[model samples]
Target: MVLVQTKIVFHVDELNKWPEVLSNVTNVLMDLAQHDDHHIQMVVVANGDGIMGYLIPSINDQISELAKTVEFHACHNSMVSHGLNSARIPSGVHIVPVGVIDLASLQDNGYRYLKP
Candidate 1:
């Protein structure tokens, strides 16, 4: 059986309200993945100061749950600039070479972009 999928890449470039961002995005993604016909694939590319959101202690469990649906990525370049090392970032968040280029490639490959 063939399945249709909705792909998404959420790019976060600022260190805005981390909790709200994840909460809102998770709500929207869960709603999108509700129907059997819609197979939602999502990844959040966090760069700049936004990468710190994934390390919040209050949302550790939420991040764990989010990982089940959303793949979280951190920008290594941003990490260096922000003085953050891999040892400090959460385990589940994958560290990519560059977040902007990754975001661009995802868009080029047809993943819808949301920077919220």
Candidate 2:
């Protein structure tokens, strides 16, 4: 039997959307886990003000929990623009040169784009 791969990239650009985005990520993972025919590759990319969520203790903890099942990415451009440094980023989160470009590249490679 062949297992199909489903690639999904979640984009978050606003700080206020972290809760919703996290909820959506949890739901998506749960929904997909019920099926065995597909292998999932999920990524959450935060840019703009959304990267600020990583500095908040509460949100950061929540993200760290989900990081075990979802890959997390932060935009270096956004961090620099907001005067944030690598030390402020939570563990398990990757630093990307640019969020928009990364999103485009993922989509071009057949990963579905989701903004929540």
The candidate that wins on TM-score is 2
Candidate 2: the clashing residue pairs are none
lDDT of 2 by residue, 1-116 (tens): 78989899999999999999889888888888898887888899999999998998988888878888889999999999999999889878999999999999989998999997
lDDT of model 2 at position 67: 87
lDDT for model 1 comes to 0.81
Task: Encode model 1's per-residue lDDT on 10-54: one tens digit a residue.
Answer: 877776756666877678777875766668778888898887776
TM-score, every prediction: 0.86, 0.93
TM-score between candidate 1 and the true structure:
0.86
Range of the 10 consecutive residues with the lowest summed lDDT in candidate 2:
29-38
The Cα local distance difference test for each model comes to 0.81, 0.91
Runs in model 2 lying further than 4 Å from the true structure: none
Off-target runs (Cα >4 Å) in candidate 1 are 1-3
